[model samples]
Target: MPREVRELAEDPTGVDAGTQDAVLLFVGGPLDGRVEIREARHGEPLPTVTHVHLHGGPKVVHRYDLTPLGPGVGVYHLRPQQVVRDRSVAD
Candidate 1:
């Protein structure tokens, strides 16, 4: 199931001053169960894409798209965007 979060981050413009911080939840793929606090205004839209970079052997990039649960609440589900390989690493 997707987790619900409220817009708690303070607006830099002082329009939506919040006490807590807003969060984006990730479900599935390498970022499952990850919660990220993001700065957002009261009426502004949230981010739609999340990028994750992995380094060790060959560099890999993972992309996740936001799936809105409700206002200020959404889940980032892993999408088959692409897997980038380092140029130094042979295919």
Candidate 2:
């Protein structure tokens, strides 16, 4: 997890400059306490799923879904979504 997210999660008001856009805070799974800055547009909905790909060893992907926390802020929790594996690679 990124340190900035931990800081922001602790104090949302302490968001740094140039990140005035809507904030997406991740909770649970590998992305727990991670933060993502998204451009907020009127009538446009935020992403429902967040994808994290691991390429260090066996290729894998984790998915998380958004759970609204409040206006301009949301917590994306790790869902029961199946982990995607790169079948192209040999075990």
Candidate 3:
């Protein structure tokens, strides 16, 4: 599975402009592992993410830095324009 190939299959660009951008920004970085893409927002810190690097799509070329906001109780929100089924399995 590669970014280029996946991108063709699931074109984030085809999705709503705002949603596509949010998805890319939300999950664009060196992730510990690949997680599924969930549309609905969650209260948990780690919800499934869909972005350029994590998802097998045409986003491998982009570079992003993950900065910890801080160790505090704050509202972290994720607003998605659309939701897609995830195709990941645990080993």
**Highest lDDT against the true fold, candidate:** 2
Worst 10 residues of 1 by lDDT: 12-21
Q: What TM-score would candidate 2 get against the native?
A: 0.53
Report per-prediction Cα RMSD to one decimal. 12.1, 13.5, 20.9
* lDDT to native, each model: 0.64, 0.67, 0.35
Candidate 1: the clashing residue pairs are none
Deviation in angstroms for 32 in model 1? 0.7
| Pairs of colliding residues, candidate 3 | 3-57
lDDT of 1 at 79: 80
Clashes of each: 0, 0, 1
